[model samples]
Target: MKSRTYTLVIIALAAALTAGCASVAERDSRDPLESMNRAVFSFNEGVDKAVVKPLAKGYKTALPRLVQNGIRNVFSNLDDATEFANNLLQFKIQAASSDLMRVAVNSSFGFMGLFDIATEMRLQKHNEDFGQTLGRWGFANGPYLVLPIFGPSSFRDGLGLAVDSHFTDPVYQIKDVASRNDALGLQLIGQRADKMDALAALEEAALDKYEFTRDFYLDRRAGLVYDGRPPASE
Candidate 1:
């Protein structure tokens, strides 16, 4: 159920990215790839105006309690493993080691579901997401790609999606066809839901929404590669 919802959410989001940039493409006559990029941004803008913003608002209006947040934490724990792996691959030894400890302790305590018990065990969750992993591996931000329906992403980050799907995902382990897909999709949507509200707030007051989004995406990608610790000055 949750997974299926999440799948649609992914589709919807991909469309959003593409569509959001489409309008910009129309105004600026660029090369073939740039035109495509614009179209994606156009589509994402529309989805934001329509679906993404509303879903985010609805979620925020009804806050979860400690118990529910705990459960959400548990489910999110499964993802920490992959994040750990990616961090190691990207050369963030300290954070990667921390995630490994998290997975070990959580799995031992049956908190593999990430039930916040891991925190009590002193296993902190180091924030990790896929796009950042790609940047560290020498992939240039190919182009600012507004993925139609997917919302904001660059060509580089877009490829990151495939990396995450292939390596980080544990969905393949789910036995039941319906349940597995449902769970996977739900997770994706849930994460998206968490971000939508913040994004909406930021976008609402931006001067040049497109440029703002473009710069924002790049800045975030760079920040992630360096694990929020800015590089040392020369």
Candidate 2:
């Protein structure tokens, strides 16, 4: 039933993003379903406070720095596959090559991505996603949304997540179901642990946390889609 709830949450966010709304320049004008988004945001926040945050804290306290770095490297190696595929789809041959090289080098010399030898070799890590692919092809971002668990996204990005999960991500292709699930769980806990201090600062600084998060996510996504050089608004 917990899985069902997560699905419903994604659906609700998708619906909101797809609904008709004003332009981005108008500031929050794109959020036609603000009420629903806020509710889901609160629900996600409650879940984080009650379960994810505590688990992350425990995980951080228990793990040494070296272990934590290894866990992050493992996930990043997995990300290289998705990033390479997206780069190819977006017609970025150079980036795709770099991503492929990162995977090959790390998986071989880095002991199955327990380290990041590629970075030391000056191989840049490029972030790409199906959402960015769609954007490059002229697909609109639609509206902003605050999805449960997943946090902020747009209609395009939400669909991209689905595509990445089913197609691009190697985690799903793992033959052993238990191992796949364990890898995913570790990735989640590692991510949450890394975000603890940043999240705390956000809570302390933002008077309206929802708005702050929404704007920040949208801006950051734009930066990612444009490879950190988003065009200035008119």
Query: Looking at model 1, which ten-residue stretch has the lowest summed lDDT?
Result: 25-34
TM-scores for the candidates: 0.69, 0.89
Q: Note the Cα lDDT for every prediction shown.
A: 0.62, 0.82
Any runs in candidate 1 off by more than 4 Å, and if so which? 1-35, 48-63, 108-110, 120-122, 129-131, 171-175, 229-234
Candidate 2 ranges with C-alpha deviation above 4 Å: 1-10, 13-27
lDDT tens digits by residue: candidate 1, 1-234: 324334544564465456556645334222224555556568777876687566645655565655446546756677777778788877889888888777777776755664556677776677665667766666666555655555567655666665665567565356688887766655545666667657668767848666677667666767776767645420
Task: Give lDDT: candidate 2, residue 180.
Answer: 74
RMSD, one per candidate, in order: 5.8, 3.3
For model 2, name the residue pairs that clash: none
